[model samples]
Target: MTADRARGALAVLQDADGKFLCEVPCGYIVEPTASAYHIRRERARAQRRRRAMLRRRVALTVALLTVAALLAALMPWSGSGAADKPKDTTAGTLEEVHQPTAVLLPSSGTVAGYVPNAAEVEALAKLIYGEAGIVPSTTEQAAVVWCVLNRVDDPRFPDTVLEVIEAPYQFSGYDPEYPVKEEFAILAADVLTRYRAERDGEENVGRVLPAEYCFFTGDGRRNHFTTEWKSTDCFGWTLESQYTD
Candidate 1:
């Protein structure tokens, strides 16, 4: 039966109408015994009554103990749910005990390392091509150039562009699959020489053919210079948009 219905039945048994029967059939219990049948019957009935009383007492005791246990388990043994979570009281408190107190610095450097020298730039360009094993396009070259410049200028990376490119653990340099190409090495040397000459105002010194910030391809065409750079109305060409993917 359901617990509720069983409890209802137990309640009925506790009523005055449910008082002990004061007697039980004894003959059935004493058929094999060699004694006064009526006396034996009386004793058996009394024993049955005693057993019923014990059973009821045990059940009541168990129910009471269970209720007590449940109450104990649910008491505010701790505090509220919020209290259970370690209160970050130290968050607003100036107390030193509560603070994490640990400080961190960039593993790379305060500013990205120096601009790549001619040899270093050549090594990096060749290394990347060797690792990627892909023919270097003007746009890809432009990307590396910009990444190097930005890295050198920014303190978040290695001190120099070449060092930033060669940052440890990020790129596996000696992997057989990533073979540095000879063409990249040649181009690296060429580009570095040209950049040096241009910086020195040696050739095409005054002409503004390409903006310095020109870094990527936007119109599905790589290394294509825009006519807007030639406009006299534009005193200076902004290379900022060159890195569009």
Candidate 2:
């Protein structure tokens, strides 16, 4: 019938089951309502807004989880540094940006290991002199030089000051067993001793060995080869000898 009749019939149908079937006709008419359309649109809009908010929440949660997982994976290999962003390597940790120690050793049997104090130098000098029968002198420090050199190569050598000096084949102190010059023998022993010390990663022994060439021929004379002959080869040092006895 009419919209008024349909609404009245619908209200009556709500109160009683199957009673309005007798009053209503079989033919139907759809009557649209502005209030109904407005309610439907509002419900749809509310649903859409709810769905959009849910999607945004899910996306934010996923992003946070991804960032947390990445941080967890990186933390093991990563050092002390910034957050999600990278930091400057120049502003590193204390261990990373550390300065090196500033102690030096010389072939003169002087603090020729990373020994920072004067006491260590004097003790090392005495040890070199006592074992190898060499006097630790300013001019004849080659034996100390040799000992320092060899010591750097191997730390397992005799740790005693004297033992380091007298270590076997450690220094070429034993030359042709002729009546040796007292002064020369002492100087040679000193050099051999120090050469051994320098080889074992001893920072003190660095740059202490003299750049000078000490050449000794079979003729018993201290020889000096020209720069042309000596410049290319440190093997020229083969002539340099350290006397053990």
Best by lDDT: 1
TM-score of each: 0.29, 0.21
- Please provide the root mean square deviation of candidate 1 (C-alpha atoms, Å): 25.0
Best prediction by TM-score? 1
**How well is each residue in 109-219 modelled by candidate 1, as lDDT tens digits?**
122332435446454554434332232244344343443444454555566645755554322322222323444444444444444445555654222225332221122
* Candidate 2 C-alpha lDDT tens digits along 66-168: 9887865553211111221222132223342133322234346533443433323333433323322222234323434343434444444444444543444
- In candidate 1, residue 87 scores what lDDT? 26
Worst 10 residues of 2 by lDDT: 215-224
lDDT for 5 (candidate 2)? 51
